[model samples]
Target: MHPLADTYGRRFPYLRLSVIPACNFRCTYCLPHGYRADPNAAGPLSLDEIARLLRGFTRLGMRKLRITGGEPSLRRDLTDILRTAASVPGVERLAMTTNGSLLTKRLDAWADAGLNAINVSVDTLDATAFAALTGHDRLSDILEGVDRAVERGLTVKLNAVLLRGVNDDQLPAWLDYLRTHRVGVRFIELMQTGDNLDYFRRHHVRAELLEQRLRDAGWTALPRAADAGPAREYLHPDYAGRVGIIAPYSKDFCAGCNRLRVTATGDLRLCLFGEFGIPLRALLQRDEQIDDLVRAIGGQIGRKEKGHFLHEGRTGITPHLASTGG
Candidate 1:
């Protein structure tokens, strides 16, 4: 049994590792304008380093892993990284989260490299709106990428960031689109953090409102089947897949939080909205043994804050989502 089991006795084994910190598109909600480019920001965890981390975590009973980034596809050695991760012992599932910009050409390769599933960040269907949100008019590319992922038999999930006035009206359209495509659609509520506060004041769409709208439109919202991430999932009455609502601001799911994040720079974050983390890069550089790393990870997990107190005037402690692993 893993030593890092939480209060509910659930083993905290899953890890979301960021392979790169820099992104090609500067989404308005993610990064602010005049985003200074950090030259040393993106160099990834080397295949050897990642493999070592994977093996070490598995040794401590980790079974699930997800690769994420500003855009994991931007990594030149992404395929190699996936292959290495898939071969790790005790890693039952390996997944990735990407912007879907380069997925059209790389879907087959990613699947062949043993990537188990994929989550694509797709906020709006309108080409103009998408371009405005991402700072790049690559809507066609993203759509094609989604199609290719489905064709390659990958579990495709569309991650939609619901901004109040910007794309809330597009929710129903996205649901209709997903019904025909047979993929999951997740609606994420914007959280106030870093540059997000500037955007959230103008665009925070609460999940309760979205859920009510869907029900009013004659859709049934079902409870989630498992203890997944922060996303509270629901099944539309006639829809094949599911719809997930991640309301970090409106309703926090801190008690059920099961995952942890490892940044590209090698900081292990216990919670997506938490401030505390330990530098894994320094430990790795010092060759501190695996058991020591596991103990450190467990110690960090033990101190996880109950939840993000957004209603209690909490705003700026959490790191940007892009840098913290999607």
Candidate 2:
């Protein structure tokens, strides 16, 4: 099998596919005004297009496929998408990241469709704080869904964007939840996007502070999996669950890059914060174009830079995380 390796010899065995860019919630850091449709924007990839896309990537040694979105569950054909991706011969892990608002109603159906793992966004456990942060008052219901997901035996992980003076003080509460539930809670450092400069300055807290806290609490660092996302995970003997820190701005954050992203419109993003995307939608229209599609992808993979310029105050073309499935 041909592996997708960059100039720096980073092999990409994982792929994050964005199914849609429209999200329902008005998260403060992402889309505070909610989703505004672009008049000239094309609709998301069709099921057939998605299948062809997956087939193309699998040929290049993609073994893990993570379906992401502004909120992936919003798609009407999400189950079909999941099944199509799972049917890809080389895709060993089929997972998704959702906001969890619809998890309780759709978890069983999704699991039946071959989704073996999931990451749910739960920024805060407090109902009031959650509503304030995400513009949704469904914290309790979402947590119920989290519990249900764990009960269903899916590999469950919770994503909480670490916001200063917001949910930063809630680690104790998260730790308490982790003590009993065998789930993984990840605190993502708030990142600066093309549009959220002011907000990023106000809310972005260094992830190292939390790392020191974890070290003080006796949490031992855990070894990373070959296809894992950029998270420094830790485990504690007293807790059933684990904690992870996704510090994008940290030193050498992109040194171990092993995943590539495809936008909802079928543009290949070599890096989430890259300067541009190479459109692959036309090639995905027919099965006959697989060879050309793979060539285009491999050619671009060689151009990936060593790391993102996020530290230099450049977020590239990414207006927000939703646009590229961060």
Write model 2 residue lDDT over 184-256, tens digit each, in one string.
9999999899999999999999988999999999999999999999999999999999999998888899999
Reference-based lDDT, each prediction:
0.76, 0.94
TM-score of each: 0.91, 0.99
RMSD of each: 2.4, 0.7
How far residue 64's Cα lies from its native spot in candidate 2, in Å, is 0.3
lDDT against true structure, model 2: 0.94
State which candidate has the highest lDDT.
2
- Candidate 1 C-alpha lDDT tens digits along 1-326: 46366655555667899988777878888875524557756466787778777766777677778999878888999999999999998888888989888887888888998997899999998999998988989888888888888878887888988888889888767877867786788888887775566677898878778877767767665654332556766766577777777877654466666677888767787677666667776455434566677677777666666666676656434556787776
Error of 1 at 325 (Å): 1.5
Where does the lowest 10-residue lDDT sum fall in candidate 2?
1-10
